[model samples]
Target chain A: MIDLSDLSKSFGGTPALTSTRLKIAPGELVCLLGPSGCGKSTLLRLISGLIPPDTGRILLDGQDMTQTPANRRPTAMVFQSHALWPHMTVARNVGFGLRVRGLPRSEIAAKTEAALEMVGLRGFDRRLPSELSGGQAQRVALARCLVVAPKVLLMDEPFSALDAHLRKSLREELKALQRRLGLTTIFVTHDQEEAMELADRIVVMKKGAIEQEDTPSGLYACPATLSVAQFIGQMNVTLATARDGCVAWGGRRIEMPVSGDLTLACRPEDLLPDPQGVPAEVIRITDLGPLLRVALMTPQGEALTWLTPRAAAPLPGARIRLWPRALHVFRGETLLETIQPQRLTLEEDA
Target chain B: MRRFPLGGLTLLTAMVLAMLGPVVTVVLWAFAVKWRYPQILPTEWGLKFWAEVLSRQTITGPVLTSLALASVATTAAALICWPAAFAFARLRFPGRQLLLFSFIAAQAVPKFALFLSIAVIFLQLGLVGTFPGVALVQGLSAMLVMIWIPTAAFRAIPPALEEAAFDLGASRLRVFLAVTLPQAMPALAASYVLAFVAVLFEVDSGLLIGAPKVTTMPLTLMTLSAQVVVQDAAVLCVMIWLPCFVLLLLTRRFMTSRGIAEGLGA
Candidate 1:
């Protein structure tokens, strides 16, 4: 287990990481998700001891490792740039950590071969870094870290340089490798879909602080704030007036418990066209093979989108009606209302 | 239709011939047995002049002396330049820009003016006629240019390579030796060659401080020029130019192989 408490760092008088705390269980794969310049990489550097924190205590396996340098720490990082040494061959690069630890040449060679085999680079031991392709270079970097048998593996956008198809394949490969080794890992990225697909738990960050941390499904289904909802996926926020167990917006009222002003969120796929639903006008329609994105303007001039199985073949400037479920409500950054799912009663009981 | 500009090619050929004319004339006169006033060509040709120059023991000693001094001076300059170049490329200490500017200024100043004072200092230290004294003088003058050009080359290397080495648990020294130095070898070789050639022909300090006791080919050529006719002086001049010519040939070969000429659009 690794724990960071009150971690903070600054570069040239600018705060890179503010006071932050996080905990990772043994063998857990947690991802730090944020946009660019959101301080996710800074946190990883601090944990790996690449840069010392201004104020913090890092505990690994119940031992204080705050003052330990990077070489002494049982942590390794695969940088976003893949920082492979161009001068060394693949085998030497993988065995660098062992050589630094004063291991025998035979032991270093054996461990290096094993690590290379683990990363599916068994025959590439004699090749220089420049000889490898982008994906192969990343695999060499991963092998370099794995050879050390570090307790915690830190990756900072390791797949960002790869093409989309390769990225998907490598992520699965990395996940499988992590599970087999049972290594506790911290993966950092600005990509939301990657975070959702790979992380057991995702930590959403904004600026220098974490906004929310939860299972990927939980964060997606129940976002904590407007920022979290918009960052994680497509969100259409509508302002509404709340009064006496009902919310009213754009000339439509929905039955839900409300206490004050509120914001409503609905996934694009949830909204649909119904002849007897609230009146709306179709603004634009885009077809995307498996789905269609339909944009509509309400009578009060509020714009929204809904996804359907087929393109709505309505003519331009046609009016339509959409019935969407009641929005999850939040008041002043606090969860204020959740509408229970409506149930249809049987006529036999009646 | 546009006519081909034979005029430009004619002008370029003329420029090349103009540069080669004087050296070609000198080599021809050096080999002639005799030439008199108003004669465009020699009256006779023989190896007598070459034999005279080659057989002189005094001339041979100065050639050896000059070779030794230049070799030692160039090697010393390389030793002093490497670390300074590395630091100038990598580190940001206080007064870095000022120090770098000082080295540039040292290269700008003419060596003759500095040699006068350096001679007095050498005499005071009782090193007036020694090989080490001449070498030290040449090294001091050549150090700035040797170090600065190579420092720029080293700076051009990607810093990512060094960072990668460090992340792999290598110390700073190991990173420098394993990565940075190998990448900068081509530049370092160029700098050493340039410094060696510069020191080989240096005469100002050597003549000013160690003329009577310590001798070099350049000082000997100067003496021979003053005593003999211009035709006789040509032989000594050709002899002195031979080694530098060979060195220039070697540099040209290196420059071609390294694509430095192509890079410069030469």
Candidate 2:
């Protein structure tokens, strides 16, 4: 288990991480998801002991490892660029840690071969990093880190350099590899889709603080803030005056159990075309193979997007109505309200 | 319509002739037994001057002494420049620019002005008339140029390589030894060759501080040329040129195989 307590770091008097606390269970794959420059890499570096925190205590397996150097720590990092030593051969690069630990040459050779095979780089022992393709070099880098058998593996956008197809393939490969190794991993990425796909639990970050931390599905289905909803996926929010279990928007009053200046949010897929629903005009239609994205403008000029089957094509100037099962409501900038699916049905019945 | 009228083939021929002209002249003169100033070519050619110069103890000892001094000085300069170059390339500190500029500035100043003061210092230290003092002076003079070339080479290495080494559980020293130094080998070789050539021709300090006892090949050649006629001086100059010729040949082979010239822009 890895634990961070009141972790804070500053660079030249500007704070990067501010009293952040986190815990990862053994064999957990937790991803730190945030925008660029949001201190996700900084947190990973602090855990790896590449840099020390100005004020914090890092505990690994109940032992304080705050003062330990990076090489001494039982943590390894796969950098975004996959920083492989270009001078050494593949086998030598993989066996570097063993050599540093003064292991016998024969033993290092055996272990290096095994590690190479594990990363699917067998028979590439003699090739230098420069001779390998980017993906091959990345695999060599992964082999180098894994051969050390580190307790915690930290990856900072390890697949960001690959093409979309390769990135998908590598993500699955990495997930399976992590499971087989049973090593606790902290993955950092600015890409939300990648975070949702890979992480058992995602920690959403904004402005150097954790906005929310939950299972990927939970964070996607029930975002706690406007920023979280906005960041995770495309969300349409409508301003509504909420009072007395009723929300008013676009000259139509809907049943909602929220008070104050609330905002309504519904996923595009959940908003379906219905004969008896809120009146809207299709301002634009975008066909996206399996799903069609229809941009709707209410009579009051409020805009919302709804996903429908491509077969059910809606003309650009067509009039329509949309009834989404679930909706989220927020007051001001905070997610202060949630409207369950039954409320929408009750409003339809009334 | 063209920039210069010298065609490529003409330029190539001219460059080759210019390089070979002085070397062929020296070799021919060293073999010639007798030659007058008005003569375009030698009347007689023999090994008589070569034998005479080789047989003489005076010419031979100074030649040996100069070789020993240059070898020791070049080796010492390489050693001193390696770490200094590494530091200048990698680290950030106060006065770094100033320190580097001071090294370059030392190269620009006339050596004669410093030679008088260096001689006094060497006399006070009782290091005058010694080979070590002369070699030390030569090494110090060549240190800046040697270090600057390799420093630029070391700086060209990607910082990612060293960081990668450290990430893979290598210590800082191990990273330099395993990764950094190998990449800088071509530059290091170039620096050594340049330093060797610089030390070989170093005569000002050797003449000033080394006076009567510590005689280098250049100084010996100077005295022999003055006492004897121009032909004898040219013969001595030819004799002196032999070691430099061997060094140049060896360095050419080394540089070509290692691609040091292309790598370091030599």
Residue-wise C-alpha lDDT for candidate 1, range B1-266, written one tens digit per residue: 98978999899989999998989889988989888879988889887888887888777788888888888888898899888998899898999889999988877788888888888888899888888888899888779877898899789877655655565666766666666676676777778777877787788967886677889878877787788556557887788688778776776566431243223211
DockQ of each: 0.23, 0.29
Using DockQ, give the best candidate's number: 2
iRMS of each prediction in angstroms? 7.7, 6.0
Off by over 4 Å in 1: A240-247, A255-261, A276-278, A311-318, A331-350, B1-60, B117-130, B157-159, B207-212, B217-266
**Which pairs clash in the backbone of model 2?**
none
Tens digits of per-residue lDDT, candidate 1, A128-206, equal 8889999999999999998989899999999999999999999999999999999999999999999999999999998
TM-score of each: 0.81, 0.82
RMSD of each: 6.5, 5.5
Model 2 residue runs over 4 Å out of place are A237-264, A276-289, A292-306, A315-324, A340-350, B1-60, B123-129, B153-160, B218-266
**What clash count goes with each model?**
0, 0
lDDT of 2 by residue, A1-350 (tens): 99999999989888889999999999999999999988998999899888899998999888899998777788888888887766567887788888888888899999999999998999999997779987888888889889889999989888899888888888888899999999899999999999999999999987777889999999998899988998998888877777887776545567876677877888888786666667788888887889888998887778988888987888998887777777888877677656644423323311
Place model 2 in a CAPRI quality band: acceptable
DockQ of 2: 0.29
